[model samples]
Target: MEFDYIIIGAGSAGCVLANRLSADPHISVCLLEAGPEDTSPLIHTPVGVAAILPTRHVNWAFNTTEQRGLNNKLGYQPRGKTLGGSSSINGMIYIRGHRTDYDDWKALGNTEWGYEEVLPYFRKSESYYGGTNQYHGTEGELFVSRLQLHGVTKDFIEAGISAGHSHNADFNGEEQEGVGAYDVTIHKGKRWSTASAFLKPIREQRSNLKVITGALAERIILDGKKAVGVSIRQKGKSRQLKARKEVLLSAGAFGSPHLLMLSGIGPAEELAPQGIAVLHELPGVGQHLQDHPDVVISYRSPDTSLLGVSVSGSAKIGATLWQYLRHKTGSYASNCAEGGAFLKTDPNLDRPDIQLHSVIALLDDHNRKLHWGHGFSCHICVLRPKSVGSVGLTSSDPAVAPKIDPNLLGQEEDLQTLLKGYRMALEIIKQAPMAKYQLQDIYSADALTDEQLSEVIRARADSIYHPVGTCKMGRDENAVVDSHLKVHGIDNLRVVDASVMPTLVGGNTNAGTIMIAERAAEWIMQDQATA
Candidate 1:
């Protein structure tokens, strides 16, 4: 098969790419996804994310190298494999990150990425609930809604406010410092994933676009230095497809850089050792990995405020499910980690260095372990860790997952910041709104000394599932892509995803990923027009 544009990975950014590129009407586009079609009912409901995310079918379910910081435990790294990518199975927080996150990119010589310049793309991709304004868009493809806060979720916000944290109604608005309900990529009680927001409406109408699911992209088919197409395998059959113009990779952070390495476009030193022939030697293909390092303070709530396996809590679950079915209302509509805060650990800091997620359950070990009864947990992650991580080949085979080492707390300061964040969270929960909900502190609060907290931080610090920077975009020698997102030394090729973020955003990365795709699509069209 042949097309004007071939997008590998029909994920968060890929879905947006498919929509915008095919809108020209004359150009043809092919979007390939590794997972099966997102037809599962679990992909629609907001609560269904909890059911689908832990599974391997709809998720990549990658695990990092045993972290020295986390008592040598492998961290859970779940990347969405289906049409909407991670956006399909994520917490669906619609945070664009702090304005300074983009400015930091510009500070690194990515001049086109300042907050003011990229704000338009963010607005262009969103159909915000409050309608069009300076920071949000009403006539856009993606739907962004403020989740209807449940009792405990609201209380979490109130508790943060009582703890002297500012009450921010809109995190995406004038300022990002505060506690409030998160705006999620959900609408009308359904999970409005990127595929739902961008692809669903145009799939039938766009005759020039083709979407192929269960198609695993193995490598880029390059002619000398130019990416000509993609080599894919589906149904035990390998097929080669041509790209008339561009072979855009929207394959998330790990997939994009891994593909480049597989295509013989990475550092020859790493490629030769992996038994893969080197076609192009780019030292920075799979370097500079970064992700949020988080630790959870799990507490048992005596009241039935948090979800758990208590007699009353279990009964409420049935009633909530029934309510969800009848009117799409109730606690079932929550993203689980309903609302939280973003605050700076130091007063002199220009922006927040730590973020909190007040989950209405005991979110221990990324929900890998189930505890006894009703409880609420506060998750605090160092927003900007000095620790650096990396992604590399575990095997030459595409079927094998990449080696992810998010070196969480590899730096001592990262641990110090998280400890500070944990203390702040405890302060909030100890206050009025949340104090009433607590029966007793799950871990004896008074018994938790600084040493005990340090032990816990090392034992529990894991990712919040926001891994980025494997294929970094910048003007440096180690950069994989340029400011325009074009692969540094390759033609007809570009990576449009979170991989391009030179640094991790100050908050959830889904919204930033969408903004990146929005800009990429527009740049692609602009370049095409000039051509």
Candidate 2:
């Protein structure tokens, strides 16, 4: 089979690309996904993320190499494997990140990626429930709305305000500092994944677009330095699909770099060891990895309104389930991490360097650890960690998982920043609004010194699930893609996903990734007109 464009992953970015590129009836596009269709009941239910996240139901469930920073413990990375990708399984918090995040990208030589140039693309992909404004779009495919607040979530926000942080109604608005409820991607009580927002509505209508699930991509078929097609194994059968014009890789940060190395388009030294011949020696294929290293400060609260395991809690959930089935309201309609804040660790910093997530349940070790009763937890993370890591091949075969090493807290500054953030989180929880519930600290003691807190950070901190910049875009030798998202030193190939980010954004990456695809699709269409 041949197509004008072959998209390697039917993820958040790929779905948007499929929708926009195929909108032109004359253009034929093919999207390949390693996972199954987004059909699970858990995927559609907003609160079902609790069940889906801790297990491999629809997740990649990739584990990182033992991190020396975290006392040599392996970190869990649960990426969504369905059509919508991570967006299908994520917390659903909609954040475009601090504006300066994009400004920093432009300063790093990606001239067209400044915040002002990219804001329109962000607006173009959103249908804000708050109606159209300078910061939001009202007529886009994806829906964005405020989370249905629980009493505890309201208290968390109040506590933040009482703790000296101003209340920010919109984190994606004029400024990204202070505490508030997050705008989520949930709509009509369902998880509004990219597949739901972009692909499903148009799938039956577009005959020019072909979407294939359960297809594992093996390698890019290269004609010298140009990518011509992809070799994939689907249903135990080998097949080769050619691309008439371009092959776009939206396989995400890990998959994109891993596939490039398997296809011999990465660092020669790394490929030679894996028994793969070098096709293109791009040393930065899997370098500059970044993730938000987080620590959860949990407390056992007397508040039974929060989600947890107990007779009353279970009964509440049962009732909530019934309510959801009937009217799509109540706790079942909530995304677990409902309220959040972006704050500065140091008052001197230009922007907030730390982010907070207030969960309505005791979330320990990504919810893999079970607590007996009701509780509340606050997740604090260094928004822009100075530490960097890499993603490398564990085996030459595509069936093997990549050796992920986020190297969380590998830098001293990150650890110091986290320590301060930890104190801040504790102070907020102890504020009058939250203290009225009489929550007991379950993770740490008040007597623990800064040094003790640093040790705790080193032991408990792990990724908040945002990993990016492995295939960064820049003009430097380390760059894998150019400003137009086309792979450098290679023709007819482009990487349009989070992997192309030159630096990690300051907040949730889903919104930023969709914006990238919106921009990329427009550029591709413009190029097609000239071609």
Candidate 3:
């Protein structure tokens, strides 16, 4: 079947595109997801993050190259493979990043992408719990609500205030550089995934919309640089689906560039090794990789308030599961990293350079390893790190995972910033509110020297799950996508996902990506009218 538009990867950006573009009823839209449909009950439950994260069930679970910067340790990247994309399995934190990040995009030659222009889209795509306001929208496709703040979370906030940081009620509000509770993409104690908010509701109603699961988009069928269709694989069979008007590449940072390279749209150097013919050589297809590199400061506490599996804790989980089944409220409704803070490492910096997440459990190594007893952890991430990495093709085969080298901590300043934030986290723990519950420093000793801190930072540092900029949008020669998200050297094709971020935003990528799709949908419809 021919479609007016074919969207690859039904992720955070793709689902929004499907909803907006197909709402016309006349335009046929086909959304191809490489993974399964978002059907597992664990996806809806907010607490199911534990179940989905550590496994490949609904996660891509990609790993990075051994970082020379991190003592040759490999970093883990868990991307969502299901319909909602990473938004389904993520921590559900709603952060649009600081306004300066978008302004920087505009400054770097991307028109119509400044904070002032993008604010409307962020507002348009949100259903804020605080109702309609200047910064947030009330009636929208996505739901953003308050976290069920645990006593430990409250103590963490009080400790932040005691540490001389302003107490911010809403991190999405006017000021961003402060400590506060983060708003989440949760509705009635369930994760409000993009599939839930946009696609699922209207799937059966819209006859023009087609969603195919278990389909891998191998490559774009390019006819002299014009993307007309896609070659997809499913159930050990190959099929070709054509797009009559345009093809939207919403396959995300790693997948978007991987598809481009596989379709012969990337650097000739990368394709030559993979033995793929060069179709459209855009040297910037898989360069400029950026992400938030982070480390954790953990403390062993007998805090029964947090999630832990002991004889008594296991019993509580049983009772909590029953409570969650009946009313969707209990310990089972947590997104784990509920409370967070965005702070400026340097006072005069325009925006926050460091972000901290207070996890209710001992989350280390993406929780792939289990630790005994009850404890809490604080994560410090270097937002907008100067260090950059790349995604490259490892083989000619489409099914082969791309080589992801984050080159983590390539910049000494990034490590320095993380060290500063690390020290700040230790101070927060020492404050009055959480002092009673704190037992001992589970990860490091007290008053360690700079060398000691540096060693620990490298050993523990990993991706905070925000990878972007492989197909960055800008007007420069290195840019893969133009201001309107259209591929620079390709026709009838556009990239609409985290890969197009010109620079890493100050916070999470979910809200920023959804806003990008919201704006891209308008652009597509406007182009449709003119065409």
Q: Using lDDT as the measure, which candidate wins?
A: 2
Q: Write the per-residue lDDT of candidate 3 for residues 435-529, one digit (tens) a residue.
A: 87865676677548988889888998999999999999988888999889999888999999999999999999999999999999999999998
- Candidate 3 lDDT score at position 388: 95
lDDT of 2 by residue, 1-531 (tens): 999999999999999999999999999999999999999999999999999989999899999999988999999899989899999999999999999999999999999999999999989999999988899998899999997798888988998999999999999999999999999999999999999999999999999999999999999999999999999999988899999999999999999999999999998878999999998899999998999999998778667787888877777878888999999988889998999899998899999999999998888888899889888889999999999999999898898999999999888899999999999998888888887667887758754888878887788889989999999999998899999999999999999999999998999999999999999999999999999
Residues 1-531 of candidate 1 have per-residue lDDT tens digits of 999999999888999999999999999999999998888777878877666666675888998889998889888898888889998889988888889999999999999999999999999988889988898899887888887786788888998999999999998999999999888888888889999999989999999999999999899999998999999999988999999999999898899988888889998877898899999889998899999999888887777757777877788889989999998877677788779899999989999999999887776777767778888888898988999988888788888888889899899999999988988988888788876775455553664788888887787778998988989999887999999999988999999999999999999999999889999999999999998
What TM-score does each of the candidates earn?
0.98, 0.99, 0.99
Q: In model 3, which regions exceed 4 Å deviation?
A: none
The candidate, 1 or 3, that scores higher on TM-score is 3
Worst 10 residues of 1 by lDDT: 438-447
Give each model's whole-structure lDDT: 0.88, 0.93, 0.91
Query: Which ranges in model 1 have alpha carbons more than 4 Å from their true place?
Result: 443-447
Ranked by lDDT, the better of candidates 1 and 3 is 3
Candidate 1 Cα lDDT to native:
0.88
- In angstroms, how far off is 376's CA in candidate 1? 0.8
